[model samples]
Target: MDVIYVIDILGTFAFAISGALVASKKEFDLFGVIILAFVTAVGGGMLRDILINSHPINWIGDLNYIYTILTAVVCTFLFKSKIAPLRKTFFLFDTIGISVFTLLGLQKGLSLNLPAIVAIIMGMVSAVFGGVIRDVLSREVPLIFKKEIYASACLTGGLIYLLMKQIGVNENVNFIISAIVIITIRTVSVIYKLQLPKIKDDIFTRNQ
Candidate 1:
């Protein structure tokens, strides 16, 4: 089995777990939990594939993705009480998902001979849009739209990955390095309470 494929499955499971936990917290029904899990696991990848005109989208082409998501949902359902107390667990899984998804999308773009800039954008989309959809459904402000350094971390990691590839870095080495870069940035930002600068809250009120 390809290492990248393994990593992608792990990422999908992580994202599904996060979504399931959130839905559980929201007191969503079983159906809602499954729906959120499915969307959060594959929404970004599906969107990326559609935008690039890739055939049969990722989850559709691979039944393992569905099984992975269902397993994640079941685990979350059984372990919600234990999992919910670990405040950082959700963040950790989300970070992992973004790290893996970004590289996968970027690799796909390159495989299709897309421009590097376009590929980087694709990476960001794959890393971000799933969480965007998850948050929208849960009625929370999306992380990328808030002060968090969410999408920016993915974008930066994608750029560095492209640069490393150009410099003839080993494929596996480049992927590991890029994934770690994203995870480190996101984890550090959260640990240190770092945030992107925002306009003063009064700006909108003043205009009104």
Candidate 2:
């Protein structure tokens, strides 16, 4: 398998694990967990593919995606207790997945010769939409709604990758650098519990 393809499958499975955890927390049935896993694994890429007209979608043309998600979900379920204690490690995998998918999205957009703006948007979409779906399924407001810099990190990585290409840097080095930037930002944020301040609710503050 191509290196990129292998990364894509690993990314898919890691996100599936995230979704399965949420489903289990919600007391969802087996079928619901499967749906959650599949959606969290492929929803973002599918959305990006559709937007870019990358047709037939991703998981559809590749049954391996299904098998990968299934395996991830079952294994996650069997070891849920152990896995719960390793949230940070799983998040490392999730961040890697985000970086890989963002790069792939930018590549796909640029393959069509899309403008830099569009490519960045595609990259952000590819990275975060799956998390959005996962949050909604778990009955939580999606993180992107309040915006604590998750999508910003993806866009920053995409823009950096594009800048390096424009400057004629080695493509492989550019990829490594961009992915590192993303993972670093995500890791720091998680370690520090960093989040943008929420706008305080004040419905009672009326000028009557």
- Candidate 2 regions off by >4 Å? 197-208
**Local distance difference test values of all predictions, in order:** 0.89, 0.87
**Model 1 lDDT per residue over 1-208, tens place:** 2876777787888889888987888999999999999888898998999999998998889889999999989888888788778757667767887898999899999999999999999999998888889999999998679878888889999999999999999988999999999999988987798888877777779789
TM-score of each: 0.89, 0.89
Residue 87, model 1: lDDT of 56
Candidate 2 deviation (Cα RMSD): 3.6
Least well predicted 10-residue stretch by lDDT in candidate 2 = 199-208
- Candidate 1 TM-score, true structure as reference: 0.89
Per residue, candidate 2 scores C-alpha lDDT tens digits across 98-172 of 998999889889998899999989988988998898888778899777856688789989999999999999988
Clash pairs, model 1 backbone: none
